[model samples]
Target: MQITKLELHTSCLQQQRKFYHEVLELPIVEENQNSFTVKTGTTALVFSQAPNTSSNPFYHFAFNIPHNQFAAAKAWLASRTMVINTNGKEDYHFEAWNAHAFYFLDPQQNIVEFIARHNLSNESNAPFSSESILSVSEIGLPVRSVSTTCEYLKQNLSINTWQSYEDVFAAMGDENGLFILNYIERPWIPIAATPGIFPTTISLVGDFTEFTLEDAMYKIVPTAK
Candidate 1:
């Protein structure tokens, strides 16, 4: 699956905007008083100010980087922001996924990732930069029951599980894009903090129809080709 756009809520709209537009050097394609859209390669990432609530909403999402640019991308991001350390390690090698990834937290403490899938043929000879980001590769979907959610998506969308599935976690879609279904209260990958499963809107190129998830916290829309 290929994610074309993702809409997420943010308590710190201006700060998040500056982080993406200035710190990461992504181009802002649209903006307003309440929200702004930034183009991260092919995916349009939209962040709108969330309504007042007791707790601030955050999320976990990832960008696909060139297979051969992991080191450069890590260095580039580390220089701009602090790369999250996992068990004293800054980068990780996922043997099962055949990918290397690093994590960071945005101003709102949203977990962000830059992942390089070695299995893909998207190696580049050019220097690594913000422009080298290919697309939005992953978005975390925290659910009460991973198995139930996985079944629902498979039945409704005709999407297959990427690799494996367990009671607590399952990855839906292909390497180009994925919906990471994680059990609620489960800490996100490479991080031990409480998970953030805020309201999200995902637009993608896929085979299924558009529908809202259980609690209306998520809206998945498949665009026409």
Candidate 2:
């Protein structure tokens, strides 16, 4: 599956626009007084201004970078801002997934990750930059029950757990894209310490028929083609 678009709420719209358009160097495809959209490879990430009463909304998401550009991409990001450190490490290697990743926080305190999955031949000869980002690879969905969400996905979308599964955590979908279902209030996997669950919307494409899932805090719409 491929994430075509992701909609998020932010209390700081202008700061987010600057961070993504100027700091991250992503092009703003659409903008207005209330929101802005940035082109991130195959995904269009949209951030709308939240209501005054809304809490400081945040989420966790990952970008798929070229397999061979991990170091360059990390350096590129580190040059602009501090790379998040967890357990005294600035990067991570998922041996089972054959991937390496590093994280940083945006102005909205979102745990943004740049990951390179060596299992895929998405290597590039061009220099590493924001353009090297392939797409939004993963989205963390904070649900009350991981098994319930995973089961719903399995029965409806026919997607199974990619690699890991537990009562509190389950990764659905495959390497190209995944829905990381975490138990509510579970801290995201990063130094951000942000809660996993939030009000989020994701629009994606896949091989199966179109479908939609809605809950109190999350919504997923998939377009089949």
Candidate 3:
């Protein structure tokens, strides 16, 4: 399943504003004192503020670019700042798949990334630019536990796990339309649509058998009912 969009929250408006609109060079479609919108190729990446947010809900997101454009994207990003190498450059290449990419953190320390894969196709090059990302290729979520989170994904979410080592569970899309729920050990807070905070609850929560991220799940201590 392909990712449609991602909504994240941050506390640093000026920092995030500069990073996303200036550094990333995404076109700010909407803006105000509290929030802003940028084109994520085909999907839209909107940032907002949150109140009463939990460290448990914080996360980072990533994308896979065309292999040919891998160097180009990296070059473009480098032209902006050398911070693209915020993550370790030693572990950049995957020996198993020969994929190339890099990672960095937003002002919030949430890991962000861009990767290029040999197995994936570059055929679907739709109308896109650095400002407008096409679609969310991958998503990251921090969870307290992997097995319980995985069971929630497998049962309630219908996501199929491709592999599981220890604390992480990698998965692709099922009929529910999800790709790669990379679970980690950190926590994240949710922001609604305020633009400059980290305590907003969530956006339109809906019920779709197709999985529109309608009900973005949060980890809970199941009751002994």
Candidate 4:
């Protein structure tokens, strides 16, 4: 599945606009006083300013990059901002998954990642830029029950877990797009932040069907040709 758009909340909109537009160099597609949308390659990230009474829970998400541009992408990011290191390692290679990734934090302290799935055929010789970003492919969804959430997604959306441990974590969907479901209080990898459930909405492409995971209440809207 391809994530066409994702709507998330943030406590500070101005800072987010600067981080995404100036630092990441993602073009703004739309903007208003309360919210704005930026183009992350094929995906549109919409950030809404949260209310004062609400807690703006941070998130973890990944962007797909051309496998061939992994090194260049890392260098490009490092030159612009600090690349996060986990256990003194900045880059990570998952041999079983045939993927390489690096992480960083956004203005909202959200864990952001650029993941290259070598198993896929995405390759490029051109210099890596914001254009090299394929899409917002993975989103961390904190749930109370990993198994129940995975089962709901499998039955309702026809998506299965790509990787998981019964009570801990589950990566659902294919390499192109995934929902990282984890039990609350579990710390996100490469960082020490505890996972928390927040309002989120995702739009998927290829099949025009939509559903919402009641437990997490994440709306999944699909679009088709």
Candidate 5:
């Protein structure tokens, strides 16, 4: 399923605005005192202010990049910020998935990724920029039961798990986008941080059904034809 918008909570809105707008150079679509929304390719990432008692939610999310510009994108990112190395390697290739990816941390210390899926054929010779970011394609959803969560998504939304391991992790949805259904306390790959469930909502294309799983909700909405 394609994610049209993803709403997440942040303890500090000013910092988020600065990082996404000034630092990353993403365009701000709207804003107010307590929250703001930034355009991320086809998706709108909204960060809202959270209460002091609420722990800042950290997530592992990825952006799809043009396949031909992976090298340039990597170089551009490294020149601007530190890239997180997985097993002492900054760039990673998943042969089975036919994708390349690298990770970094945002201002909130949430793991952010840039990935190129070879199967999609998004190739370009132009210089890579924030605009080259295709979309917020993947989100890590930490839940108590992987099977139950996957089943719920299948039954309610017609979304299926792309890959899985019993009680460990499940990659749900297609290559263009995925919901990383990870078991709670499971450390996210290439990092030491364990997944945590903070408030989040995702609106998917072409479906208007809304449902909650493990306190996080998903809303289906219309997609532009």
Candidate 6:
């Protein structure tokens, strides 16, 4: 489902304004001293003020670009910041998936990634570049419910369920847009974004219409599948 908007809090506005808008190059919805919103597909994620928030309330996400423009996308991002992960890897070539991906850290240290290939969705052989961003590719939400949330997303968002294993529920939608809903217990250990954390992330895939509902309900926790 596309995330229309996500409202969360950040302790530092300067950093928030720069990272999402400047660094990641997402479009801004609105901005003030207290709050800011950035485009994530059809949805805009709004960030407010909060200090040392635990569970992060949000996890990590990815973006999809035209398969052919992988080189140009990487070059553009490299011009801004290092594309290497904290582990200093330049790219993760998934032989199993036939995809090439790279990651970067946001102002809040969220692991943001750019992927060159997606197994699902409308593909373009035209080539990828900064201008070829298809849409927000994947979103991870830290929730307590796995099956319950998956069912709700299936019924309302038209997301196709692919698998639910361990604490991760995998789904796909739109064009090559895949999301992983990470579910875990309430008490989560706050790990550094260096490698990222789990049970505390929500990803917005596809258009922004998915979050327009007043009651954007997602399940919390569910028993092991």
- What's the best-to-worst order under TM-score? 1, 4, 5, 2, 3, 6
Candidate 6, 164-190: lDDT as tens digits: 565554444543445565654432112
Off by over 4 Å in 3: 52-58, 84-91, 95-98, 123-133, 172-225
Regions of model 5 farther than 4 Å from truth: 216-225
TM-score of each: 0.96, 0.93, 0.69, 0.94, 0.93, 0.66
Per-residue lDDT over 1-225 for candidate 2, one digit per residue giving the tens place of the 0 to 100 score = 778999999999999999999999999999889999999999989999988625888888999999999999999998999899878998899998899999999998998999999989899999998898889989987777788778888986777898765587888988889998877767777763747455787887855544444445676777653
* Segments in model 2 whose C-alpha atoms lie over 4 Å from true places: 192-196, 207-214
**Candidate 1 residue-wise lDDT at 31:** 96
Of the candidates shown, which would achieve the greatest lDDT relative to the real structure?
Answer: 1
Tens digits of per-residue lDDT for model 4, 1-225: 788899999998899999899998999999999999999988899999987525866899999999988899999998888899877899989887899999999888899999999999989988999888999999999888889888888877787779887688899999999999988878998887888778899988755467777455588887652
Which prediction has the highest TM-score against the true structure?
1
lDDT of 1: 0.90
| Tens digits of lDDT, candidate 1, 1-225 | 889999998888999999999999999999999999999998999999998745689888999999999999999998899999867998889999999999999998899999999999999999888899999999999889888888898898888998655688889999999999888878886778777668899998867778888588899998764
After superposition of all CA atoms, the RMSD between model 2 and the true structure is 1.9
Worst 10-residue lDDT window, candidate 2 = 207-216
Using TM-score as the measure, name the better of candidate 4 and candidate 5.
4
Q: How many clashing residue pairs are found in candidate 2?
A: 0
Model 4, C-alpha of 202: deviation from truth (Å): 0.6
Write candidate 3's Cα lDDT for 1-225 as tens digits.
444445667666667788888888888888887777777665456666544334423455666666556666666667776544323341267655457667656776656667776666563343334842335566654444566667765665454665455665444453222334444433321211111112222221123333222134532111111
Candidate 5 positional error at 3, Å: 0.4
Cα lDDT, model 3, residue 80: 76
